[model samples]
Target: MHVKFLIIGAGPTGLGAAWRLAGHGENDFLVLERHAHVGGLAASFTDRAGFTWDVGGHVVFSHYGLFDRLLDELLGEAVLRHQRESWIRVAGTFVPYPFQNNIRRLPPELAWECVEGLLAAGRDAAAGVHPDAPAHFRAWIDRVFGPGIARLFMVPYNFKVWAHPAEAMSHRWIGERVSVVDAGRVIKNIIFGADDVAWGPNNTFSFPLRGGTGEIFRRLAARFADRIRLGAAVVSIDPAAKTVCTASGETITYGRLLSTGPLDRLVADQLVGAPPALIEAAGRLKHNGAFIHGLGFDGAPPDSRCWMYFPESDCPFYRVTNFHNYSPFNTPDPDGMRPRLRALMTETSFSGYKPEDPATLLDRTVAGLAATTLTAPDDAGRLVSTWEMAVDYAYPIPCLERDAALGLIQPALEAMGIFSRGRFGGWKYEVGNMDHSLMQGVEWADRMVAGSRETVYTL
Candidate 1:
């Protein structure tokens, strides 16, 4: 089979590119997806008990007008807007999200420590005596947040979430993700106990009212489904020859190729006879896997909070989301024959340094809920549904070596007429959100058609 434009991985990135192609009245393109459904890591499903769970915690906030308009068209009135109510659990207390901003919620003494550190940090910044750039995430935390807040929450909480010590991570990729502390606002909020929320674009987000996060992608894929080949996993690719072999033992050649899977896998494993240094660089690419554990319970009223972070060692899971609070449609209805149930979703990370056994993860996640005061004794006893899923490429870890490795591999692939684009394709967590990933696809399609520059996934 020969396609004018051949694509791999029918997730958001591929679908986004395909949609752009369709918008331009180009229908000769075909998208090859390994899975039967779309959405990649953003996918969602309803369990046997009729409870919907996302791949993990997924909320939609846009940084682009095209993506916003696409959602408006696909979801229309069914889109549900939400106010962000995120929190963090540490020192046996639930502090507001971005823990540094709400130090007053901590115990008086610890809160004092955080305040003192913030003041000291402010003093340092005023003096203009800090590193031009932090050596790593750990140094960045200590420098930006000061030692008090870093030790109390930033260090430990980030450790759990990333499943790697802060020192192992690079500070280059946290462009807009990390919230910097504002001493004046922090002091004001602390003095009067005022909630200083609404920090980022996600302060107010939107979701589908009916389906889980997947519904958005599913609806988008519907527009270009005729060009999508589901369950067509590409086993190998001959980049030099511009051909891909699917699992069905069929060979498909393409004029231009855009792959949305892991860049490391494409170069090292899939692309036959790639450069040795590129393969070695691909090996250096690091990622943390995810284990999602969900619990549904029979309850009258669920916790109204959106999501909470864990910085302590009390819980194996780094972050927990009150999934039911995101949407009532996430759980089953409470008719006379059935009891309405609320849901809790937790995610644990695993890497060589912080390995997690899938067998014990479910139990550990349940115990973690109780350990962190998320569940009461009564609520713990009455269980309704439990489900767990794993994604191999949860986070593309931005290490000291990540960009250097990408600097080597991406250029080589593009030279061979391949455009690797998407979350893992670009491997830039800073630009790896739903909006960024989709735009990467859209821009890649535009670049292919009009010789435009690809900004988001630039080599």
Candidate 2:
């Protein structure tokens, strides 16, 4: 099949690109999705008991005006807008989120130490002793919030998320994502004994009121009609000839290619020609996959908090989301007949330092849940339905080696008339949310069609 644009992956970004391309009256494109479903990592599934679960934890906080309009146009009034309430489980206490802002919750001794550090940092900032550029994530935190908060919340919490120490991550990506504690506020809070919660603009986010996030993609693909081919995985991409071969033995030639697949896997296949150094660096990009352990219960949502961060060492999973709180539709009606769980599913694999087993996984996640005090040990066994889904690409690990690696790979792909965009494609941890990913794909398509500059990937 000859097409103007050949896209891979039918997830939000892929579908968004296809939708935009079609809406622009440039409908000469075909999208190939490996999975039978439209949404890639955003795909949702129902347990035997009819409770729906997203791949991991996905909530929408639209960055662009166009995104909000598109969502409203497709899902109509079915989407639910919820107030986000997130916290962190630290030292056996549920600390309000943006923990740096809530240091009053810390024990008296720790709070004093943090305040001392912040006072020192405030003086330094006023004197302009810090460097103009932040070298690493740790330095960035320390300079902005002071050393004490960095040691307590920023350092440990980031370690849990990135699987690497803060020193290993670059600071160029920390803008707007990491909260910097204001010295004035910290001192005022210390005097007034106030806790800083609800510090960021993302306190309110939106989610589809029904059918999970995947519903957005499903409807988008439907709008595109036959342009999208589900269960059609691309086996190879020959950039020299501008053709892609699918697993189903179909060859598609296109004028432009916007690949949303992982850069490492894409180059490993040599489907498209990339520089040798880039391919080598692509191999060096390190990431740890995730196993989402979703539990459905027969009662009202557990807590108003949307998600909780785990910084302590005992828990295998870094963060757990009380996803039901995202929207009323996430869980079934409490008064309605809650179906008995028909089965329990557990998935396990090796990614990090130690290999995890399915049996051990069940125990670890359950125990972690209890350790974080999200659940009781006794209530662990009562989860009628539990699902453990292992996703190959979950949190993109921004290790010390990541920047150098992506630096080599991205330029190489750009030279081949291929734009590798989206979460895994760009491998950018910052701005790697659903909204950013969708814009990444759309921008790439726009860049190809109208010579518009890439917005999300420039950083």
Candidate 3:
């Protein structure tokens, strides 16, 4: 079949492009999703017992006005807006988020170190002395938050998440991600006790009323049902001929292509006529794998906080979401009041199967939870319901070779009028959030449809 636009991958990025293209009403498009469903990592699943789990954890926070508008239009005003309450796992205590800002909550010595570092940073700044060159992620952290905070929170916490040392990563990608407190303000706050809750874009955000993030994409696909083809995996793309071959052996032709597949896989394996440099660059793109362990409980909520960060090495996951806190729909009935049973007490569960005894997994998760200080001992063994989830592509690692690699790859595709884009697509962790990814798709579509340049690409 021939169409004006052929979109590969039905994830949020692909869905967003399809949504915008259909809304534009000026093009005939077809969306081919490798998965049977539309929502990619943000997809949800319902158990026979009625528990729901989102892929890893997804929260909707927009960096663009257009993304915000699209979500509001699609999900509507009934969506729940939540004030984010997140924490960091530190020295066996749950410190408030942006942990560098809350050093006072840490032990006396660590707090003092953080305060002293702030003071030193102030003196250094006053003398107009800054690092002439920040060559690594560690240096970047030090420059932005000072040595004490970096050592205490940023470095260790980030280490847990990325599973790679800070010194090995690049500093150029950390511009707006890490908060750089004014030296005087940080010290003054330490002395007089000021809280830095209003520090990031995710301080406040929205969640769906009926489901987790998957609901948003499911609805987006619903609106453009005729153009969407789920369970139809695009196995190959011959860009020179503008054709896509699917897993089921169906062939499709298109006038223009918008792909949201992984940068490496798309050009290297899937695209039939990829250029040499694009394949090489795709090979250079590196990402971290994540095994998301979701534990569903049968009792009261664990904490009011939305999610918690882990800097410690004990827990396997760098972050854990109180998925229930996203909405009532995320868990079973709150009023039903089932007793929570604890299952496994270890960080890693080797018993691959879902434990018949729900308490076993819950126990293990709670033990790890307590070990991580994410939960209390009193709350460990009572979970009656339990579940664990895993995702192979939860994180895109910013390896030392990422930029140099993508730099070699992206331009070659661009030269062919193909824009490599999305979380795994553009392969830029600096700009790979849901909003950023979706906007990348929309902006790419705008560029393709109206001869406009993409701002996300420029950024």
In Å, residue 79's CA in model 3 sits off its true spot by 1.2
TM-score of each: 0.97, 0.91, 0.89
Largest lDDT belongs to which candidate? Answer: 1
lDDT of 3 by residue, 1-459 (tens): 899888888887888888777767845988888777888877877655566777676788988998888788888875888899988878767778778777767888888888778777778767878748767888777766778887767887776666667777887777668777766665566788776777898889899887678888888888888888888977888878878899999999888887787777888888887767667767766665555555655454446778777766665556788777777676667344555322221122122121123344444455667687655666545455555654545566777788888777777766655667788888778788889888888887787778887888552
Clashes of each: 1, 0, 21
Per-residue error for 44 in candidate 1, Å, reads 0.8
lDDT of 1 by residue, 228-265 (tens): 89999988999878899999999999999999999898
* Ranked by TM-score, top first: 1, 2, 3
Candidate 2 pairs with clashing backbones: none
| Model 1 misplaced stretches (Cα beyond 4 Å) | 334-340
lDDT for position 212 in model 2: 81
What is residue 108's positional error in candidate 1, in angstroms? 0.9
Best-to-worst order by lDDT is 1, 2, 3
Error of 1 at 52 (Å): 0.7
Clashes of 3: 21
